[model samples]
Target: MPVLRPLPTQGAGRLADRYGRVATDLRLSLTDRCNLRCTYCMPAEGLDWMPSAQLLSDEEVVRLVRVGVERLGITTVRLTGGEPLLRRNLEGLVAALAGLEPRPVLALTTNGIGLAGRAEGLAAAGLDRINISLDTLEDDTFARLTRRRRLADVLAGVRAARSAGLNPVKINTVLMRGVNDHEAVSLLEWAMAEGVQLRFIEQMPLDAQHAWQRQTMVAAAEIWARLDARHPLVEDPADALARGSAPAELFRVAGTTHTVGIIAAVSKPFCGSCDRVRLTADGQIRTCLFSRSETDLRSALRSGVEDAELAGIWIAAITGKQAGHGIDDPSFLQPDRPMSAIGG
Candidate 1:
């Protein structure tokens, strides 16, 4: 349980942090139990999964999101997880979120293992779009990175998402040196043929193993050079400017209308304009992904506080948000919660 700092006066009726960043995008984790053990995320044996009893119930999740949307002005809600597809009543939860007043733009970030079967149902339930994580195109490399032989299932889920009318079904790929870094060009080519959005993300230090080394990690410049070699790249100024607060930097695959995005979180940090907040599966509010401290909202919710009061707790949580993640700083330290538990 983290301490609740004093709530700063609500500025402009938004979830504003001290540095003037307002959070309208909410990443809400549905569960902490993931199916795949990605090398950069979890250990091979998997974590001691959170007891289901400790997680926020569907009803509790709805109430918290309602406070976020109605009271705090959250406009976008992204359902994330250790793996969101594992949640049994996901469709029902989606429908409930879709019914919020001034209904939010709902999305989901998944690993795409079981998404093939649920894509259509989720879209029908009001999911706006999806982002599936795919690090490599080769089955052998996929197995090496994720410790799972479900690359076929992941690809199928990408197609299923498109079939379900989730336009621009984005694929999030992490480039790790000596792992899947060689597949950058191949992965982009595959995504181009499939007509889905592809984003190359520089590996960050959110791994549960805490073995990430900057020297061993692939940088944005390396990824750009690799992809540019195969397909000449040009910056999409229009899209780049329009992508305000978006982490990815947009570039057009020259000679074609298709575009690619790169999220240089470590190399070209985007902490200055970040407008996102996260809610852990167990009901902690984190204003930053690298947050060392989180405010406990579950206790207040269980104590039977009104929605307006819950809104105050949420405000206090963001009051002390740091100026930046400071990954490049000499004093930088990884958060206690790994990416899986933190809800990327």
Candidate 2:
């Protein structure tokens, strides 16, 4: 690979769309392959996997990260996937990303099926933190929801990640009305006991069949009320730093500094403050998670495009970003791709 000319100071280049929201975070999907098929994330069978040759190489991912950091002023990155750990040589990619100049903060969103064995290597390779997707605490619920028998493995992975010093390990749970909503308080209590930060996400319309209905969503207000009824919640305003641009709204448990977060993406739209963009495993760049269109960077990259050209393609995608993802609108049309295809 040829070397590209370096840009000026890191924070000097601020990337913003027409809406004036600065883009400081990027989500890079490593692959679309995952071990488990979550009911809300993917169809049980016949998931179309992208040809391996079409996926970006480790060097390619690093180069884009460099362009993003140097040219677009992205300071934070999260590696997401159908399951990021399924990709071969992920630790190498982590190390490469960690070596960048003005190195951006790095993290991963994983299913945690095999994370128990990999946590130490990833932490040592300079990963900043991780968010594990674990919906219910029951093994029976796990099998029914995911159609898999890996609940024990995931729980073990969480313990291993904490033991490996993954600070404030976050567990992402999606609350489906009748599915996992009943466990809201139990999940919070579990997080408190285990010392892992817990975040409850409202189910979005990103499922495979477009079967997601508004009636299924458990509102953030309800989640809080349920938990508060059991254990009173007094807002802790001290976690102000984790508020802006972050999807999660943070609050401390009553009387103590322990925190709980609610990422109300649907009920409370935060598009105006959205600071993130996504790159699919197959190399399509999406400005919003609910975006109907994507810019094909893989085609451009394979054509041997220059750094400026690559940066321009990315900028064009961000420039066309809509004011907000119109999920609440009755006229909203779901994206053709599922969460797995869209990158976690």
On lDDT, the leading prediction is: 1
lDDT of 2 by residue, 47-144 (tens): 98989998998888998889999888989999999899998999989998999988999999998999999999999998999999999998888998
Worst 10 residues of 2 by lDDT: 1-10
- Give candidate 1 regions above 4 Å deviation: 1-12
TM-score of each: 0.96, 0.95
Candidate that would win on TM-score? 1
Residue 132, candidate 2: alpha-carbon lDDT: 98
**lDDT tens per residue, model 1, 25-97:** 9999999889999989989999888898889999999999999998899999999999999998999999999
What number of backbone clashes does candidate 1 have, counting pairs of residues 3 or more apart or in separate chains? 0
lDDT of 1 at 228: 94
